[model samples]
Target chain A: MIPYLACVLLFLIGLYVVISKRNLIKIVIGFSLIEYAVNLFFALVGFKKGALAPIITQPEQVRMGVARNFVDPVPQALVLTAIVIGLSTTALMLSLAMRLYEKYKTFDISEIRRLKG
Target chain B: MEGRILPLFVAIPLAGAFLVPLLSKLWTRFADLIASITSALLLGVSVYGWLMVNAGGMPLHYWVGGWRIIGIAMWFDALTALIVLIINIVGFCASVYSIRYLDRYTGGRWKFFTLLLLLIAGLNGLAISGDLFNMFVFIEISAIASYALVAFGTEEEEVEAAFKYMVLGEVGGAVLLFGIALIYARASTLNLAHLSQVLAGFGRTPFYWFVIATLLIGFAIKMGMEPFHAWLADAHFSAPAPISAMLSGVFIKVTGVYAMSRLMFNVFGVSRAETPAFFNLLIAFGAVSMVLGGLLAYTQNDYKRLLAYSSISQIGYILVALGIGNFWGIAGALFHILAHALGKGTLFLASGSVERQTGTRNLEQLKGLEKTMPATTWSHILASFSMAGLPPFAGFFSKLFIIIGAIAARMYWLAFLAALFSAVTLGYLTKVVNMAFFVKQNSSVTSTREAPGLMVLAMLVLVVLTVAVGVGFRGVLDHLVGPAARVLLNGLEYARLVLGG
Candidate 1:
């Protein structure tokens, strides 16, 4: 319960940074932070306190109803996929920021406001 | 049902995406030929799929690797067919336009085609995926490609706009994933069919409402709803014209509106008797988007920016129809989706042509183009009439259906406001025509030719579609829109079909 709340807090902090920060790199970091928090929360949802690995290498454990004590592996797989997507997108965002810096000579987002909203 | 054809939608585009770059290295013109051929092929496949489904064989599902519940599932129902038709037909036109239209941009054409194919692959995947997590990954694929496409110019404004769009899009994606995580934790499954069955008995508790709200907000931001639309105008204005057309035409509908409508009506059962508030929320959002988008669009000087805001307004009409949640309402929503895709797609392509010829999108700078660019001007005239809900155009019938749907639902004020905004759309568009065409040629203007033959051909195809859909809407309504709406109206039936009941 506490870990879930902490994950939500992390997500909120990232949201705040994205909303309040002016630096382009900081904004990208904020997005990464949100991704990590969601990934963490997802993993937490599938975690069991005293669970064994989901693998079934032994016949004995299979007979002992080991599936009951096995942690959910699907969330871990999902988290891995999410992390890779996050990494690639963050890389793209950073490269775009580098180009923006080249064109505008600044990292501050407020200074990069050529297209009016 | 022809189950095998489902995967071809994703595979063909993915193959084309990679093949274009490799082929481009060997021959320069092959990229154009291959990209056009690929989109045309996808268009053919989508039409064939629609014909197959319309012939009484539908709700076909395929399990990847034959893994049943363990592997990802893809389904091609009426709703999927409708969206696939929209994506591919518009995609085909955009690809055709881009072949010649891209000569103005500095980016490599091969890279553009590759990214475009990847985006189409993602959209096709999203439209057909039977699982929630698979949808998220597809959304990411399309989002990433679009982010890069937005910054394809590498100009300062383009980069800035792309960054802004990316930041908001990422947040929306995260929130969307969070909602999916919550749903997964509650149901202990990721398959949308399985989850729908589980959620059927779960009832509308506080957690369910929370999940619905989260998903709604996430997709709203993605679709550029009125309150969350800060990034839309900027991104649309900054991207190249073909990309702009794609963004405004199909991207918002596929990723945002269609996804949200499917989830709310099917997976979550928002159309159930207990969920009056859900419909009310949609109505409220629709009202806001309609009024605000129209009012704001009336003030824009940039041609593409104005169209982007009009997209938001037009989307509001579709949402209001969907929110009504009646037969005609759902059908109207579907019709509006197709109508807007053709009308706005043509308009944006024409705007791209105008920008290409004049080298500026500013209304103040571009004047009397009808004399020089007749094809573009006529295309503009047709699109504007359709967009403004004028008689005998495609936009008119769709908007009329929405108004009638609202009236049938006894939402008199909503119907009236929808009519009023149709006028607002006309008023602002008249300003566009007045300044860009009717006014005398500007002093700095030079002789301009029609947009390249292929570009004009693409725009003409959409214009013809706009007219054909308007005149032949009775056949369209009976065959396509009716079935798609039935899919939404019979949400529980979807669960039953997918779960083999």
Candidate 2:
């Protein structure tokens, strides 16, 4: 329960950084932190006490409390997909940040106001 | 055979996208021809699907690997059918327009078409997929393709805009995924039908409310709902013309609006008791976006930027209508989606032509184009009038239905505000007409000529569609929009349709 609370705290921290940070790179890091927190939450949801990996090797072993031992594999699978998507998004965002740096010679989003009301 | 053809809607585009780069190595024109043919074929299939759904009640669901429940399921209902029509129709026209318009861009026609095809595949897949996680996957596919397309020009501004779009869009995607995860944890299923059944049985809990909140925020950001709409204008402005048409016309609607509506109405079951709060929130957001987008558009010199802001406003009407949550309200929302898709698409393509000829999109720098480019001028006038809700045009019917829906719901003030915003919409569109067509030419635009024949043909087709929908609106309301609206009006009916008796 405490770990779950900590995970929520971490997510809030990342959200704060993303909203408050001015530097483009820092903002990206903030986003990454939030992503990590979500990923952690997903993994935690699938956790079980004294659980083995969800592998079916032997019928005899399965008969011996297998259901009680194996953690849920579905959320882990989902988190894996989420991680790949996050990697792609982060890489694309960082490359764009690099390009923005080249154009404006700065990383502050406020300074990058070629577009505004 | 019915099920077999359904997968082809996605498969053909996916295969074409994969083969594009290889084909481009052989010949430059090969990529264009392949994409054009693929989209054209998809357009025909979507129309067929529309007719099939209209003639036959209920949706068509196809299960991959035979009829196993665990395998992939693609369900096409009236709502999905409506969105599919929008996607394939706009996609076909955009591909035709791109043939000539894209010549201005740099290399790899194959890559461009590949991305376009992938985007189309993603959208069709999202529209049909019955599973929540599958929808997310397809949404990512479309979002990534759009991000690449936005940066296709590789100009400084294009790259910057694409970057900003990626950052915000990625956050929205993450939020969506997180929401999905939470729902999965509670419901222990990802199939939308199954999940909704479980949720209905469990009733609304605090956890359910949390999931709903997260999902709404995530989808709202993607839809460019007010307050979360910062990325829309820049991304639309930076993307190429045909891509702009797709982005503004179909993509946002599929990923954002359609997904939101499906979730809220069908999956979550926003009943009459709960709907008032939902409607109020939607109206508040919609009104703000309507007024804000129009006011912002009036100050824009760049034509595409102005159009982009205008799209934000136009989309707000759909949201407002959906919020009203009545039979006529939903009918108006769906009708408005169709009308806006046609009208805004025409305007974007027309702006492209004017830019291609005049070598600029600045309103102040473009003038007296009616004599110089009669086709573009006429298309602009027709589309702009339709957008402003002029009588005997598609937009007029949609706006009228929405107002009627508001009145039916006894939201007199909301109806009045919608009418007020319609006038504001008229004001901006009239300004566009006077500056681009009626006024004296700026010295810079002396060398401008009419757009290419193919581009003009595309715009004309959209104009014709707009007119057809306007004049033949009763048929549309009876056959297409009514059935679709019924699906939303009775949310419990969706569960029965999907899960069987």
Best by DockQ: 1
Candidate 1 TM-score, C-alpha based: 0.97
TM-scores for every candidate against the unseen true structure: 0.97, 0.96
Candidate 2 local lDDT, residue B259: 89
| Model 2: CAPRI class | medium
| Best-matching candidate per lDDT | 1
Name the fnat for model 2. Answer: 0.41
Error of 1 at B414 (Å): 0.6
Q: For model 2 chain B, where is the 10-residue window of minimal lDDT?
A: B439-448
Q: lDDT scores for all predictions? A: 0.89, 0.86
lDDT of 2 by residue, B354-374 (tens): 888878888888778888899
Alpha-carbon DockQ of candidate 1: 0.84
Q: Which portion of correct inter-chain contacts appears in model 1?
A: 0.85
- Model 1 DockQ class: high
Cα error of candidate 2 at position B311, Å: 1.1
